[model samples]
Target: MNTTTLTGLELRPLAVPADVSELETPAGHDFATMMDVRNRVYFEISGHHDESMSAAELLPHYQPNPDEIRFMWVAILDGEFVGRAGIDIPLEEGSKTAFWQIELLRKSWGKGVGSAAYELLENKAREHGRTVLQSWASHPAADGVEQIEPPTGFGSIPDDHAAHFYKRHGYSLEQVERNSAFDLRGSFEIVERLLAEATAAAEGYRVVQWEPPTAEEYVAGYAWMKSRMSTDAPSADLEFDEEVWDAERIARHDALWTDAHQFVLVTAAQHIATGELCAFNELVVGKDRAEASHQEDTLVLKEHRGHKLGMLVKCAGLVKWRELVPHSPRVLTYNAEENRPMLDINEAIGFTPIAYGGAWKKVLE
Candidate 1:
């Protein structure tokens, strides 16, 4: 699809082929520029300087995945790239939703570029048989707004921000999330104390740690715990499906991480009597920029609740991650506004709220 704004700018999908070889040709240059624009827009909006993803880090996301169909496009005005947009459509029959994103340089705002880009994305989503379209936008907390109360499906930000942008486009707020950060360079005494306490509380459960390419013996169990994350985690009002996982899927994910030069530290709680993996958490550090890491998935199986295993696995994983990447300055994580348990653990470990964002959804009629 092609869209022309009133200012004579055009929006269209990138001409790069779906093959990996494009990364080495002239298309590679455009891809890099596109990533730069995305990074700039993200930082400008989120006010988080250290969290931007580098080109190497974003490569895996652009690479084709068997279970997901991705589309990337750019908006050009006067022969200059001004905006980028994309959608990720799950190939599963049960999932009729698409996750979409649109990022434009600051200069392009107030123009019709974003609207045109979003319209194209909506058309693509409908063309793919998607019934629901979801997008997320980050907003920095106002000055002196230290402790933000959980959102109530509404925001107080000005109408020009992302929250209002989605609202104006007919999307309803489904859930709110807080982006928090834990300074890894700070004293480890708190983490150690939490670990000791959790270890004592979660009796009969031993902690196991591993890096990429999970051991042959634990692959199936690891995949099982990973699968539970989707169903067990608090998703608020969003429609989601229980992710299907297996040993092969785990291997494929690990390969992607390896190719992205990400160092993954996974720690899980193994029940002693049953020999079952009951809980697990993952911490991934990007090799390209070691100053920051991301807290991925942390899940405790339904049958194992109230064992303090969540704290146990998270603490163990953080410790191992710091050991592997001592120079990493901080770790970032996101949790639903209603997820008190995870938030409690995060706060107790010195993670402070950095920003707030919400999941916006629109049901296409």
Candidate 2:
């Protein structure tokens, strides 16, 4: 079937030979343009982390059997690839949800290309059995290298152009999300003071780390910690899609950590109660790149509260991380923006305001 036409754009089952070669051939140039457009639009709309795109950094997504990607939809206008959109479904089995990320080269906008591409992609999603169509849309902005505050959890959108786009189809809000980050290498004096304060408060708690725990033990520990996390987090009122963090789920997470940095803090008994802290961090480093670590989930159980266990755990992890990866310049984290208490804790540890990563959601029926 003809997947290309002069009438505007066409949608076809993303095939290997055609799609891969097209992307791989001019991958560098294509990625640079893609990155430029992404940064431009995001910077103009909502000030946030804007960086020049490099093809080498994007090559991995097109590499052999990368698991993070689900499908790709390309926009062809006047016989040139003008934009791309895709769904990134984490490979964990039984995950009922998936995420949407869309980018249009600046020149491609205002031509109805976005509408056409999304309709095709949405239909493709249904074919793939997608129950939810989630898209992360941001306000329009000019591209820059500096960081800006991301809009509310779901992104800035009184404009709601994107929301209307989804609504005109069939998407609705699921839940909102927010983000935050810290400067780890700012000043030793400040770091030392934060450490001292946290240490003073953590009288009896001792930090610990280990390889994969026994399946039964891992499941139990995660279950306990997850329950506490749910209630302690800002979303305590929202209905969680998943009930238990079981062994199989934990294992699936472990499988992704081929080069991940993980740490957990526990009491002398190794039991996870309030006052105990746990976190997982993903490391990103390069000589020419800004060194940053993404702090995934930091949890302090209910029983472990009030003693400043959260601060202690985070401090311990930071100190150890510095000792281990001294070159890492900063740490990034995301929490519901209204999560003030935790935000205060993060600020105490030197996490500065970076960008507003709004969490916009649209339900699928």
Per-prediction TM-score, please? 0.92, 0.65
Scanning candidate 2 in windows of ten residues, the lowest lDDT window is 258-267
The residue pairs found clashing in candidate 1 are none
lDDT comparing candidate 2 with the true structure:
0.53
State the lDDT of candidate 2 residue by residue for 138-243, as single tens digits. 4342354332332333333233455556556665443344445666666656666776886677666555543343345445565556545545666522322444
lDDT of 2 at 95: 49
Write model 1 residue lDDT over 1-365, tens digit each, in one string.
77754567877676643444566678677777777787788878876656677666667767767778999898887788887999999876588889999888889887778788888999999999898898877766665543322245433333346665787789877777888899998898999999999999999999999988889878988989887876888866666656788888888888878877778888999999988999998888777546588889888998999999999999988888788888888999988877889899999988998877777789989
lDDT of 1 at 150: 28
- Candidate lDDT scores, in order, read 0.81, 0.53
TM-score of 1: 0.92
